[model samples]
Target: MASIQLQGKIFIIGEIEAMTGLHIGGSAGELDIGGVDKPVIRNPLTREPYIPGSSLRGKMRSLLDRHLNKPLRRDRPQVRVHECNRLADYKECSVCQVFGIAPSRNMEDTMPTRLIVRDALLTAETRERFNEIDTDMLYTEVKTEVVIDRITSAATPRQNERVPAEATFGPLEMVHSLYTLDTGSEGSVDSEIALFDTVLMGMELIEDDYLGGSGSRGSGKIAFRKLKVIFKSRKHYENPQSVPIATLAEGDGVSALRKADYQSQISAAMQA
Candidate 1:
């Protein structure tokens, strides 16, 4: 920690807009007749549905792990994830470098986690719009789905509470910190692009894939919009400021990121 230098931070700012009904289930109380079978998670204070940072990050991590085809730990059946606990494996693995491994191993031997995803709350304007419309819940809607029994041809119906389509969550912010090891070797998504690309790839994967639960059933399809990337260095922190580097529109994220070597650009900016 003493020898390594933190060059700067790259902030990825954007909005997560639901293209279809989104459902991330909350607590299930005692089964009550006429109550929602599955309810979207909500902020206890506001009673408004929100996208938790953990959910977003976990989905991204899982998607990225799949993208890289990283190996799962068969040794621990309980914890099924790509862990970079080994010092040798960690040095070459950017997936775990960006999304941190569990601290089951020695902290001193491993690199610091690079990414941080903040909670994305329902936008105020979207909330206002939903208030005017006649949603079933405070800021959500309940849709009843029926399941059919092929054998008997009997139907069972259940209600699912979800954030209605066209709802927007923002201002979603993801921070990617830059740390240089005392030794020259560092894990990279590519030699030129480095760790920044992995974050962009995760975002793209989520957009093409889905955010929350029940993706195949068309519950959580989302798009990233109004993206802005900013750079802040140690000196910038001392001055309490950041520099805006780029702003992107919907469907222009990962491709735009891959077009340039953002790692080199940001590192140069950090040093400057």
Candidate 2:
């Protein structure tokens, strides 16, 4: 069971089907050639649309890299795009390679990785307190805290209005169900967390279903259930300094814990 202790709330933004002015089926002028469904489409059962983490992460990283005036690296591919391929052989394509695993045999039935946004926060008093410390040390600490907060809050899109809205879904609308953590760092975390809290406070949790078809004709639907957020410490894990965002709920901890205990067993079985 691989467990991560998160210290903040997990906010999910429901997927909205963007009207791309594109239609499916093969037809020049009602020709008899066979046609297929749309690509980058959502699966009906899951209601939630599939946006590869690679897509989201890549876009964000590019924007961030551009803002920072830094040259981007070729090695670190975006997470969502990497996971887009369903074929086992292609699983090593990029993002899925992180877990060192491929999509299940029934790729359509398998759950696509839920996109998550993590928000970290700190008290106002804490920020001022740190300012009194030595310049170099204080600056370094602040930078670290900023990076963590940026990573967690990276998922929310700034051009939200341009995209379709998910209001009909009730409290879960625009809400995402994911595991979150608020590692105590500094005031940097507070600002980021506050931003998410404000954005998700009144969103509805919708249960609409959408069909997600892959390039290989593999397809599945998604239905969102509950939406929740959790907070915990990084000190609990073996790699105390690292942060993790999970897709499972707190109640699902038992299964996750068991999996952590026998990771080798699970990995072996998965490979077999």
Candidate 3:
């Protein structure tokens, strides 16, 4: 009998505070008249903040690999058409075929190519806060949906390369979920931390769509965006410790905190 193959999917759940900026296109745009410009309006019912899908997908992929203890294959050529082998091949068979290069000449190293984050929600706590505010009432949390458009990248050619790489995945779809965060609550930070730690400590990338739903209130969905993967697990040595920087120097203070302890802090606060 032929050898049977088994595949496993990993599922991860966590909260991400908007670190940069985020924006969604309105239903319409306006032209400047008399030295003044009016912005387009969007549907009031579906007022969901836009979180880039690339952001979610990239983070998830990193967490997934950490959980699985498997390093992604990164040495493969960027041009897929020039490469005959698929990402699955490396996952299933550990084989990669290079186009215009002989099989023997093909590099043996493999890196993760497809990192997807589908059916994601913008922290449930964020949604609940939005709901608590009267339609007529506005709050800063409404602006809590960070504007991620201008979050600049680090000064690294590889980091620059991946930004475009992530864009190739196409527009992403955003979904909303109900997450709770209480001020003066114990273990809040810990709760988030625990959740993130759990995700990073797991293996596999599973499918989930808990946030995608349609109700009488209409569809509550998030926006989706794509990003390129120039490099994964890039590391920088600082103070005698090696830090994993997704895109070179992008792993500074806050980014490093997110990569290391932010989730745990949230979890702890939630628990408190």
Error of 3 at 262 (Å): 21
Candidate 2 lDDT score relative to the true structure: 0.28
User: Could you give candidate 1's per-residue lDDT for residues 1-272 as a string of tens digits?
Assistant: 54665666778887889999999888777323337888788887887899998899999998998899999875476778877767788878888888887776775656678899999999998999998998888778888888999999899998898899999999998998877656334342224237777888888899899988778888899988777777776567666545434332233455565566565565566445
Q: What's model 2's lDDT at 219?
A: 19
Residue 149 shift from truth in candidate 1, angstroms: 1.7
Local accuracy of candidate 2 as per-residue lDDT tens digits, 188-242: 3333333332222111111111222221222122232333333322332334345
Write down the TM-score of every candidate.
0.87, 0.26, 0.27
Q: Which pairs of residues collide in model 1?
A: none
Candidate number with the higher TM-score (1 or 2) = 1
Q: How would you encode candidate 3's per-residue C-alpha lDDT over 11-130 as one tens digit per residue?
A: 222333322222222222332221112111222445443334444444344444444454454455752212335435443321111001235434443322222355333344455665
If both were scored by TM-score, which would come out higher, candidate 1 or candidate 3?
Answer: 1
RMSD of 2: 22.2
lDDT: worst 10-residue window of model 2: 159-168
